[model samples]
Target: MSEYEFSSDAALLDGDWVHRTLREHAYWAHDRSREVQDAANAGSRCFGVYERGTGRQVAFARVVTDGATFGWLADVIVDPERRGLGLGKLLVEGIVEELDALGLRRTLLMTRDAHTLYGRHGWEPAAPVGDWLVRWRH
Candidate 1:
């Protein structure tokens, strides 16, 4: 209902927002602050959507890639209250743009329950998934 803006600057990710995103990812990140700081320090690609006036981050996504031919999406989260408001789609689109910029020919990601959401963005289950053995997903 309010103005929405998206940015790729980690500077936009404040402590409170970083904490919330990390808490939401507690399952995968044993130490959230470390992850946030690492991402910042590594110059990793990250996306955040914020409320207009407050600049409060409400959605976030990041990618790990070699800036070449492959891209992996990680840490994509939309604030529960902000879910279904198109932030996720926007974030993924941003990631796609990043991949294009990197000259990547293909991108890969795994989502437990967001197949449909990712499908809306043209991502579908890869056939012959047998190629990559299921190890551990975190």
Candidate 2:
């Protein structure tokens, strides 16, 4: 098995690596700027998964939370080259575990095509999707 280590420490995160991965791979953040990404990381509870021993960061995620009532999981990305190793599932699981410990009333996330992955970690589709709304900025 490939050993992995998970952490919620922001200081251990590699901002440049994260920017590159999200900008190139994540559909939600393909146009996200480094400045915005850095700011987001600064404000949220960030998580990273590193390959044990090598200390190389292989995955990243963040949660916007009040530490009590709510949280929104966002920017979950694993190195494309490292997919199929179960990193994404493991990362989401760890994030959910942390959120659950906070006693939050609800946690939300939006994904274009990762429902199955998130479903395995206890996430379910929010019914009446129309009740949720967003305003996009161009």
Candidate 3:
């Protein structure tokens, strides 16, 4: 049996777990407000990874897509207590499968530290550092 399982059922996601992980642990969303987080959850395709025996969520990822040709994978994080067991891989692989099923030609993500993990799953730097520009609002 697999040690972990992935589910795209957003209903299965524990909002408290997700909020705390992002707010307290994940660098990317450490200052993100709960209201914004809830809104994001409402808008994206969310995936969660759980331990097989306990069904406790240990990792999460979300994709914003146009349902046709493009997607952006974001907010991927693994619970610190559960890192290094390949749950991140399982989570990303599950998301990729779902995105592929949607027939998206390109999916993108930005990470300061997970390039190797994403690379193992077929993600590469998007045209080198300065080649891409992002305009942030707020």
For model 1 the local lDDT of residue 43 reads 62
Model 3 residue 65 distance off true place after TM-score fit, in angstroms? 0.8
Report the C-alpha lDDT of model 1 over 55-130, residue by residue, as the tens digit: 9888877777777877777777788877789887777777776677778877788788889888977787888877
Superposed by TM-score, candidate 3 places the C-alpha of residue 118 at a distance from the truth, in angstroms, of 0.8
RMSD of each: 2.9, 1.2, 1.6
What's the candidate order when arranged by decreasing lDDT? Answer: 2, 3, 1
Cα-based lDDT for every prediction: 0.73, 0.90, 0.89
- Model 3: per-residue Cα lDDT over 26-67, one tens digit each: 887989988999899889999999888898999988898888
Q: What is the lDDT of candidate 1?
A: 0.73
Which pairs, if any, clash in model 2?
none
The candidate maximizing lDDT is 2
Give the range where candidate 1 is weakest over 10 consecutive residues by summed lDDT: 22-31
Score every model by TM-score.
0.79, 0.94, 0.92
User: Residue 114 CA error for candidate 2 (Å)?
Assistant: 1.2
Which pairs, if any, clash in model 3? none
